[model samples]
Target chain A: MQGTVSVLTQIKEDAVATPVDRLVAATAPDMARVNELILSRAQSHVDMVPELARYLIDSGGKRLRPMLTVASAMLFGKGTGNAINFAAAVEFMHNATLLHDDVVDESDMRRGKPAARMIWGNKASILVGDFLLGQAFMMMVETGDIVSLGVLSSASAVMAEGEVLQLAKTGDVSTSPADYSEVIRAKTAVLFEAACQVGAISGGADTAGRQALSQYGLELGIAFQLVDDVLDYGGQAGTLGKNTGDDLREGKMTLPVILALAEGTAEERETITTALGDPDATADQVSAVVAIMNRYRALSRTLDQARVHARAAQRALEALPASDMQTLLADVVEYSVSRAY
Target chain B: MQGTVSVLTQIKEDAVATPVDRLVAATAPDMARVNELILSRAQSHVDMVPELARYLIDSGGKRLRPMLTVASAMLFGKGTGNAINFAAAVEFMHNATLLHDDVVDESDMRRGKPAARMIWGNKASILVGDFLLGQAFMMMVETGDIVSLGVLSSASAVMAEGEVLQLAKTGDVSTSPADYSEVIRAKTAVLFEAACQVGAISGGADTAGRQALSQYGLELGIAFQLVDDVLDYGGQAGTLGKNTGDDLREGKMTLPVILALAEGTAEERETITTALGDPDATADQVSAVVAIMNRYRALSRTLDQARVHARAAQRALEALPASDMQTLLADVVEYSVSRAY
Candidate 1:
């Protein structure tokens, strides 16, 4: 436990200019074009469509998914411009899911601001999310890359299924670790996998290169989500832009909760079960649950699991030729897990 | 006024077996294959997806859009099986929108049954709708017909815009006839146009043939929605599946409401404003609004407009080679308007 804590502290203390910052700088030009495309495509003749779409789009998400797409494309020496469309499309898909997920979860804050559904009403949110998806496909079609479209479209379906499965499992205290993995894979990691794969395809990756990037993406996505689950229980509100313990309040069966539930005594289990899915649960109640999670080392265990995936993500890159982009990509994967500390 | 009433009565009395029944019989074999594809495509590893999708798909909505797709493909006399995929994709798109629309409108009844949202909850409905849409795109991608995919994706964006525009205009009595036309064209007719256009393209239609079929579909779709709008105010609940005045209760600015609001006296306008969007409005309140609509000939005028578009649809078919399908299709258009009587 001391070793694990020291490793996390070392990673945090050593970071001044993080890999994400470097990656963002490395991919700024391509991302500029991607950003332009996203804003341009979000425009609609209906005033409310753009209004709601921009409200969410311009909100400060890390834009990590599209950045991954751009970075992956850059890793390949072949400079195909089609990655621009693919990257924008991937971001649109992510935003579309976020809009719908917020509505489904009845969440209030996104990126430290009121959610799109909260501002525009669920009807507008649903419609604009739909419009963005349609535009995403339209942009994909315009690129004439049927293979990339297939990857993304299939990912879109899997993501929705993941959300449905998550909804079904919400508040189910008996939800297993396996169920949580399946939920996050479907809802989160699949898009990440698709984004990287599509980027590799656009950059003229061979079958092996595509497969390598896809594996990297899948592992990185898992690590990213595991860390997110940890943050939902352990991170600060200022950094998260969302309140801590949101997963517990929403009854999301994330890794930490699943771990704690599995190890908790009967009394600790009672403490969690009472607060789980209780929208009005007090801050003190949430802290009590978090304390129980600490008692079981659930949060740290989840981070340990994240580190495993992050290492796997780094290993995926070893299959490719060594390049500066590859090293940065590896660092980005490490940063994804480390930042949660 | 007397002549208009007699014409409506004569059309009603002359109809024994409607043209829709004949059209359905004509397309039964193609429709069988489409139904099979739709059912198979709706399947998912996620149990709730199929459950909710099947509930809506199996509901009795006449499957008119897909039927049109099949019938249009048959008109070209080249039997390309790709139409089967396009037809199924079209229906999936239609069903997806219906799911989202029900959530947006907070609709209680759909096809004379409880809405999918009511049974499955809004979260499930929204996610399942998204899953259906993704499946729809996957089906289109499977066909490798980028042209058809382009058509459907663009129509999807347009339809969403239409829905948002209509939502914005809801309960706003100042909404104009032009606004009503734009709303229905975007929300309803665009899909109709795409269904036929894709079918014609798949059937090896020449440029002229494709344009003709596209025009025919657009006009027919306009007529279809106009008749539907009138039915929401003037048709019987038993025949319409949904209740008469559902549009009114939902604050929809359909043609009848637009026309009546435009022409009604101040007192009559007051009567409508009170009941419009009042979910708890009694049948008596609805009847009073219907009576006002009659006094202004709003419903009749709307039907007259539908007749004009229905005739234009038949004219568009004149550009094609004469065949049995053409004649039946023409009768189908006539029946679309006359059935409302």
Candidate 2:
């Protein structure tokens, strides 16, 4: 793991560009180990295990959640041995949810490629998801920190509950912004919160430091997901690696849709109701919904909400001593919301 | 937990009928608490969670795994206030696997009722299964015994790999007997083994005592699953709560089918192949497959193998001191095999 970290650090020294890139470079020394552990733990004697796991794990995602864990650990400048395990565990949990989510959503592609479930059947996807989750818990248990284990395990249960709640609300135009907050909190933010909190614990952070990082992660995750929800309607399909308006087509009651429904005219509401959850909805239909969102300023309002979260995430860092890592974490939050622009 | 135990014991003194009943009665003093914990921990704020989870948890399986944990703990006459949690954790793991297994296998019914996936759909089934698993780990973490947590967590990973390996082998005639052994040892026995081992540890048993109970549970679980495979072709559909020969229809390479294929003539092999994994195979086709199995004494041989495992389970008990719980556990192994008779 240490070797993996140093090699990545060498690369980073040559190329420290974006805020996230800078964060990655800053934590490269720890993240290299986390990356190596993630790959090693994903292996199994069963051939399909690695085959399906690598299809998703190797697919290029930002590895942002694990990056938060590693960064949060390093923020305290204390070298506890458990941070790598926690970071890997967080990645496994994220990937596992993705695997099962694809199956649940009947999604054909993820990360600009066919989903693992698309290549392997749903059975393999579900089983491999279970395998990843099991591995996640195994990693946590190895940490031998019962408090941290409880945090991760509890986050896992909340994530599932959040998913189920979102599933139940699918296609329901009456979903409120409050309900949407609960959904994102459960499904997305809890994991981010857990990743940071556990990393803080591993880093030998005091109680105030742990709480601060937890708040930062929670607010950042909410902002991240909010922007993602907006991107589905406003961004280019290629940029998101999915067609624009996928959330609308999938009946996902994200904040943009909820805001539009609450504020739109009856005619606009009828337009959304006609297209929402319609798998066969055409590009013209998606355009119609976006136009309604534009008329009501719902898209901008959603972005406004994301900026609010991003700022809250930045404010969370005020609990820590001023440091370059803290400034970078705050900058990353700004960068996250800036994507909507 | 102690209060719940005493209440069940008060009732058990009047009822000790069947072998499992005797085992349950002997362990009822502790198992009552495990049962309460199972129900309470399975609950969730997400309405769909408790609803789907209880649908399976309440479906009236014997709760054999938790009972084993309780019984193993009792065998040493020690209570560290952890067995109840471990027992509940074991049951959660068992039910979680069943929920996911039903989805993977596309099974329609379980425990003589509609499978959870059948009623809740695969999405809910997959998510709820994850929720239960998360809760299982949470329960273990509450015990604060990191060693036992590692034991259960590792076993969880192995069980998932086992399931995937079995799924990979489905419909493939080339699956070796050694491969089959690996599958059951992982998917089925490892949890039983972990349950007993953790219980012994929590019960203050020494390393030797823990190993004894682990071996006992392992062999017992192997015998139990072997009998189940045999019953899939031979037992009444009503008794098994599914169709006879479901394994053959699903192309599962159970012991009888593997043995028959290894020993059958080309013509017989052709007949078996026609029906294997044929979802629409008629009773006559199943009968033909059974006739081939009978001619080769495959079913009898499988039963003989189960008896060997059962005896081995009993022998494992000799490592511990003589006690009524030990005697009941030994008898329970015999009873598990007697179901096939």
Candidate 3:
């Protein structure tokens, strides 16, 4: 972890030019350590948990959480032990959530491969997910940092609660933007905020620094989620890991449709409702709904809002010292919304 | 936990003959400590994890794992801190399983009241279950007892595998008895065996002592599960915290029904098929199945096998020194079976 931190610090010193290069340099070591911990801890047994976890972890995924942790820590300095451990911890928690999410959603694909539940069965996915969550909590305890434990636990609880709320709201087309925001805050932003805040703590930053990083992460996460929702319509179905209209098929009311229903012309809103209202809504219907959103620029408008939040995330990081990690943090804000299929 | 364990130990002493008094008295202190440690650790979190734990722990349960830990220590006469910790560790693992189970089973009642999922929803139950599992791992790491960790982890993994297997077999009357046994061993017996075997490690028991305890716990667990199946068939729902026909309703094939289906008269087998075969079998159909089970004496025959296993468990305890905890262990075998409401 220390070596990883040193590499991050070196990146900050050597290159502060392009956002992508600086970001890659700052986050690569942290991501490597996170992956190492995951591989080592997850390899102890091959019976079920390890087998199932390997199927998912090996599935291609960008190490977003660890990057945020490293970036947050770099707000002060990159060479911090706390930052590296927390990075690993956040990734563990995120992976655990993914495992459970697949089971709950009855999803069959993720990250361009069959989901853990699809391959291992819901039972294996659920149990292995539990195992990983336990592992994450253990990691947090190892830091002997009570505040970190408190923050992470609270965030996890909120995440689960948001899931419950979402479950209750399924199939309802009346999902408001506020409700969408709450769900994102609980399900997505909380962890993002926690990752950054934990980084701040590791860097010996004050409460204000912690809050700023947390806000930055929260905004970034929301923007990321918005883009994901947008891509569900615009991106190719095969690569997104599920059917493009899965949200409609599974009764998931994401932001793009919600905005269209609220503000689109009546014909477009009707089109959106027709697709969302049908439990077994067809691809053509879903495509029609997407086309209607395009016609009214509802999808584009939502992207604009996401970009605003992304810019806010960048401005928040501007308070940090000029360094490669800081530059990377700013770059991630843009990347969050500029994601491609 | 200490209070509960000591009270139970006194009951064991009073229940057993003079032969077992010394063992119980000797084991009481460690059990007491383990109970305290587990309770403190389990209930320490005031929010998510602790809140859910208290709901279940205070709901009334026999702290069997901690008792096993202490008894093994006393029987082996090894004084070390590790044993008590293992005792607590096993219980934590057990509780983690329970939390997830309630969610999966969609059980409303636990210990005569609404279950964790009933009050908090499946999502909370699932997430909190994740939290407890993680906490257990955290606590286990504290002991630095690798053997115990390996045992707990393996048992946990197998338990999950068993659950998955059981799920696969649901609503299928053609499930073989061997498959049922495998599921049973994975789901229940492994943990019981693990709890006792880890106790042996703490007690400084030789290979023979550990093997005896391990086998004893395994047999006891089988008996316990058999009894549970029996109760599920005809016992009072109030006592069971679930409806009598929950298994049939949930499409589970237990030992009794499996045994009966293989050998019952053709008419009875047809009845079993009609009641359990259809994917959408109704409540009336389930009642018919239970009636058929009665005609075939499935409950009686199953109870007899359970009794045999209980007797085997008692015999397995012979090598251990006479003690109150030991007597309680013997009585537990009988008590679990005789628990029919």
Q: Taking the tens digit of each residue's C-alpha lDDT, what string does model 2 give over B78-125?
A: 433798999999999999999999998889989889999889999999
Q: What is candidate 3's lDDT per residue for A108-221, written digit by digit as tens?
A: 789878887777666667766766665665566666666766677667656765665566567677888887878777788889989988988887778778878888988888
Select the stronger candidate by lDDT from 2 and 3: 2
Candidate 1's displacement at residue B265, Å, is 1.3
Alpha-carbon lDDT of model 2: 0.86
By how many angstroms RMSD does model 3 differ from the true structure? 8.1
Cα error, residue B338 of model 2, in Å, equals 0.6
Looking at model 3 chain B, report the run of 10 residues with the lowest lDDT sum: B235-244
Query: What i-RMS does each candidate reach, in Å?
Result: 0.6, 0.7, 6.0
- DockQ each: 0.75, 0.83, 0.11
Candidate 2: residue A223 Cα off by (Å): 0.7
Report how far residue B339 has shifted in candidate 2, in Å.
0.7
Candidate 3 TM-score over all chains jointly: 0.64
Tell me the spans in candidate 3 whose CA falls farther than 4 Å from its real position. Answer: A1-22, A44-48, A70-86, A142-144, A202-209, A235-244, A265-267, A277-284, A294-296, B1-186, B189-223, B226-334
Candidate 2: residue B201 lDDT (0-100): 89
B184-276 in candidate 1: lDDT tens per residue?
A: 999999999999999898888999999988998999999999998888886522232338778888999898888888889999999999999
Task: Tell me the TM-score of model 2.
Answer: 0.95
